[model samples]
Target: MSFRPVKPLALRTGVRWKIAVAIAAVGALIAVTLSVVVHNAARISMLDNAREVQMERLLFAQRMYETSKPKEPRFGTKINDPALPAQLDQLMRDRRRGTFVQEHRNGGPPDVWAAVPLANGDVLSLHIPFADRSTAIMNDLDRALVIGSVSVVFGGCALGVLIGGQLSRRLRKAAAAAGRVAQGNTDVRVRDAIGGVVRDETDELARAVDALTDALNERIEAERRVTADIAHELRTPVTGLLTAAELLPPGRPTELVRDRAQAMRTLVEDVLEVARLDSASERAELQEIALGEFVERRVRALDPDVVVRVVHDSWVNTDPRRLERILGNLLANAAKHGKPPVEVTVEGRVVRVRDHGPGFPEALLKEGPSRFRTGTSDRAGQGHGLGLTIAAGQARVLGARLTFRNVASAAAPGGVGGAIAVLWLPDHAPTNTGSFPMLRLSN
Candidate 1:
């Protein structure tokens, strides 16, 4: 299974924003379609009404023309009316009954003209104003349509944004839960059991994640139990072997057997300890201690030839036994794989172990410790590779952090220079340098 890294700022271009853009685009399309259809229909209706009104006015002018009443309030005869539309004039000149409407360029009402060719070759014509009221109503309708279309598009975009936010939030929760699971916190869950017919994709995702986590947790537990059981089974046999080896007469061969038996017992014990750490079966016994003084004593126990330095003293609350184990493993690693003049430094609440040698393997620093798969033999000590792993686990139990790096970060292929291991205590630091000098010999 693969997982993507979290990008906090991705929300700007994530699913929600895409959904909003899609919704706005669709709304704009619909509004434009509606606008075009309505506008055409309205324009056709207005033109039909204009033709009807102009046809009636043409009939009225025909009656006035027949009477030849020049003084009456009726249609005017135009020998030449320049304002008459060319189409209308040509139609009348052909002695056909027709009308024409001309729209004003300045967006006012149109001019409706009725013209008829008289028997005496005079054109009796009258102009009827296309009502300003009708044009105003059309203009208002257009404005309303524009405002409505804009409103709908914006409203849809807002709705899309809202829905997208809800979906992304749920997805982020699921991703965070998966991240926690990847980090070995199997208890983390995206949400409760998802069900019901109305469930969405997010619900399905959450449910799937929960299922996967449960399966993974079960598998991990089964493996841990098996390892623990094997270690328990080996303990009695290994003890018996140790007793038998000790009974042999003192000689080089007897010494070899004893050493091998002891090594087997230690390996078994280390496996059991690792299993306990994995299952979180071990708990820290916290107690405040003077850090500088504590470090000096542990290093002295390991070998008085080593050196201990106290830059600044500190008081911290942590499990003494576990702290000793952690320091022991670090010192032991240095003794085995690293070179001497091994120096332990105590500064404030932090402790550091340094060894001048070929340095830690590049792989160890990069990928961290893994059981039974130690680094290259040339660069690593001969062991089951559980030393650093147990140290790391114990540090976690004590709520401290153990970090490893090359002394000058100059470790390359085949190893180069020295290595430094830093242990940072979580709790406290008291402003006390203590009775020890800045540099103290382990003796």
Candidate 2:
């Protein structure tokens, strides 16, 4: 309804992949941590069991030799054995039982040994190579753990991708709907999250946006209808009033009456034009025109006192009538509310109209001009505020950009600064490099 352009942010669609990577990292960390812990725990348990077995074998051998029994003592068991591990032999010197381990070379399994003191001041020791024998089983367990860790990581990554894809899809759909709404497409309704079955935040967002668009559309329609109705109702009566004022006897009072009536009539016409623009039924009758000549003629016809300076002229395609209306409104506003020496400058495709008066109000600059939002009288009379509004709407109809701003002070006495209204013609230049007849060469 405002006819302002909408610029949407660049939506990032990589969140799904980011989610997948994050989940995979977490899963891998957990899986690898558990794998290492479990493998270490199993290895320690097996080594402990071997140590216990060696200690029991040493005791059994010493007992069998004492009793002179028949069965050979727990295989590798001997008394005061020269091949006993030095660490275990020294550990048992105080007539106490102890266990010790010995390392093997080149990543092979270590040996487990235990020793005990006999009654004759001799040490009985035994050793078991269970670690070496269990090497194959340990390797198999390591492989299994590694495979399981990999499986968990891959599974987590896939699951993350699935979940992120769904969320991204939902969010993207909502974002697109919002973009369309911003572009004045009131028909784009997000059906999935509307009604009464909202399931997530995205649904809530969709519902809120849908409700807002409905409200805005209804408000715009109501405004347009009211404007059109008021303008139509007042048109015939204002015309009759103007006719009646002109028939009055020639006097100062009569002159005042005619001026007021004419002003009211102008206001009614402007209101009607605004209503037409709002209805979006107006189409531009585009034609090729000489830019400098067209603007100079309009300015002269509107206000002979205003200055026109054409830096470079170019033939452009646009609606001449709409462009006239736009320029007329701008010149009228400047003449009525601005200082003398108002000037119009045409620089290639741009037209600037500036006046040496106090700059536009801060509110006008920030929020743009609106109907009936006249400024305070201290800066002179701010009219119905429909002049710029109409001009902007006409510019839009002609596919042009209209902007307002405060430039530097004009070279005039008692001048701080003034408002500058700029009109930039749309340039749909030819695709080919060669120039055409209407195209102006740029320096």
Candidate 3:
């Protein structure tokens, strides 16, 4: 059998996906912001440490220069002390730019020099390896940047996945409940686990879905009771009509009255069958019966002139009363509108009823069954179009397949005329034969 795709639900806004995406986006933003702050703070702390080292080197150089300088300006400083030469050599290597020093022991280049003069007429100098200090600071900043970014990104992704999974699970439960509701299960509902940690919008949505399902089920129950009651009430008038027709005299007028009254009774029966089929509490009695025997019995009851051919003794499980009603309607339709000889055939579990008439109307053959379509011509004595509908409903309740099509036979007056209705019985029907033979007609 071919399957039809389900329609998209109009009520589902996909709020779960939206919520998960929002959480992921916010997490990404926070991770990025935290990374930036950490990187700047690490760089600033490294720079401050480098500056402090430079200041210490500068102070040491200035103190050395002050002690080496002459006390009086008139007698300028000449030969330097022995210790001065050693200190100057070390100071020259220091290369502290902010401090300065002058005069070497041998007129050679001054052991240490300053870019600018000091306040005490002394040039102070020191070396703290400023280039190496700057490079170390930069390396520390780079490490901080890399580590901070990786930690934030990984942590954020983990959190997002955990949250999304939890939310999706809850939403899926709610979705399943909604599907049950759509399939006519109004009592289905969903509830959330109680915990402050897990409490969120998904829980709220599940509660809302459950509430809606309960309300819908109540409405459906009310409508079903009303329909069943109405159908019950109608049977009385239909029974009266049948009884009144029976009291009339045996003549042409009596025949016409009986036929019309029977039609009304059939209509009332169809209404009740439809109500029963639609009710949620309705069920079918499944039992195995010989397909050939069943078809022969219905054909014999309908008309002796009609021919029936049984090709197989296959058995099928079905509600016998409903099965009888379905075949009764099909045979009645053929007898009422069909030309002289109708044929009932059974092959395996399939029963086919064909009539040698003018064939089904073109419009109905193409459109199939509708709400109130009687396939016969609109004569005053013909049916009111509920025969096929009731038969179809009965077939559904028994889980059987019923199809209508024009019979292709050249011997018929119309060449290809009338309807050939096929009903396929349950595949496992032959196994359950010990059950009751008469299935109840009412729910």
Candidate 2 per-residue lDDT, tens place, 1-443, comes to 57877888786658788899899999999999999999999888888888887777777777776787563445667667798877777777867788877777876678788888877787777776666657777899999999999999999999999987877788787787788677555778875523334377778778788898899888998988898889889999989999999899999999999999888888888888888877666777657799999999999988898999999998887778889999998988787777777999998889999988776777777877788876546355747989989998887676678888876655743355777899998864221222222557899
lDDT of each: 0.80, 0.80, 0.65
Per-residue C-alpha lDDT of model 3 across residues 327-427, encoded as one tens digit per residue: 88888878776765788889998889888777777666666555466654531136667777778777766767788888787886657756688988766
Candidate 2 lowest-lDDT run of ten:
428-437
TM-score for all models, in order of appearance: 0.74, 0.68, 0.56
| Candidate number achieving the greatest TM-score relative to the actual structure | 1
Clashes of each: 0, 0, 14
Better structure of 1 and 2 per TM-score: 1
lDDT of 1 by residue, 1-443 (tens): 99998877644478888888899889999998998899879977887788787778666756765776573435444544678788978897788867787878897777777777777776766676777877787888899889989998999899889887777766776787788777666777766522234569888778888887888788989999999999999999999999999999999999999999999999999999999999966667667799899989988987897889999998877778889999999988888888887999999989999888777777888877778866776656688889999999888777788999986543544446677899998863211221211334596
Model 2 bad stretches (over 4 Å): 1-25, 48-177, 187-208, 336-340, 375-380, 408-417, 427-443
